[model samples]
Target: MTDKKMNFEVSKYDSEIAYLSFPAHPGKGKKGIVMKQKELSSLIEGYKGPEVYLDFDENGELIGMEILL
Candidate 1:
């Protein structure tokens, strides 16, 4: 493996929602831009936090994350 750095964008809206987006893979055209609470259980085992959500592309690569603040 080669040493590489990945760039991400973080945005907070109205001090309510914090979004972390991956610039390289936008995850557009995916079923759901943000995974639902029910979906989170299967993806992240033992994670019981309701404030975090994730976005994945068709290829199952994590592309974004949404956190409620």
Candidate 2:
């Protein structure tokens, strides 16, 4: 098996919400996921930023998160 790097872009929908977008490519298509303000806060125990980092598996699939906010 080989590790494939995943790509995602972060954007804030509001002061209380944000989302991640994985652009479409060849065999894959566009996809997105949202994180609520409450969820974000709990994740980082006070996460507040305009950007965040995401983690994925060898298959290039989102596993949860590692927010940088």
Candidate 3:
């Protein structure tokens, strides 16, 4: 298992919902995920800050984070 981090942009967001995406994809359209504030905060360990990317492991565990302002 390996940890991975990818760059993403804040495509759309509101008080409760956020959409993240990469500008380019290999025929997969846009690579992105839609998450609620509750779920995102949990992955970020309750730290409310400007986050530009996400970190997860092969087992799909949220293990690390990066704050790209």
Give TM per candidate: 0.48, 0.26, 0.27
Tens digits of per-residue lDDT for model 1, 19-55:
5666634443556554333246566778676567666
**Cα-based RMSD of the predictions, in order?**
5.0, 7.6, 8.2
lDDT of 2 by residue, 1-69 (tens): 334444444434534334343332222332543222223444686656744545454456544443444
Best-matching candidate per lDDT: 1
lDDT (Cα atoms) of all candidates against the true structure: 0.56, 0.42, 0.39
RMSD of 2: 7.6
Compared with the true structure, model 2 gives a TM-score of: 0.26
Error of 1 at 43 (Å): 5.6
Better of 1 and 3 by lDDT: 1
lDDT of 3 by residue, 1-69 (tens): 324334443324444333343222222242332222233455566677655344444445443333444
- Best-to-worst lDDT order: 1, 2, 3
For model 3, what is the C-alpha lDDT against the true structure? 0.39
Model 1 lDDT at residue 23: 60
Number of clashing pairs per prediction, in order:
0, 0, 0
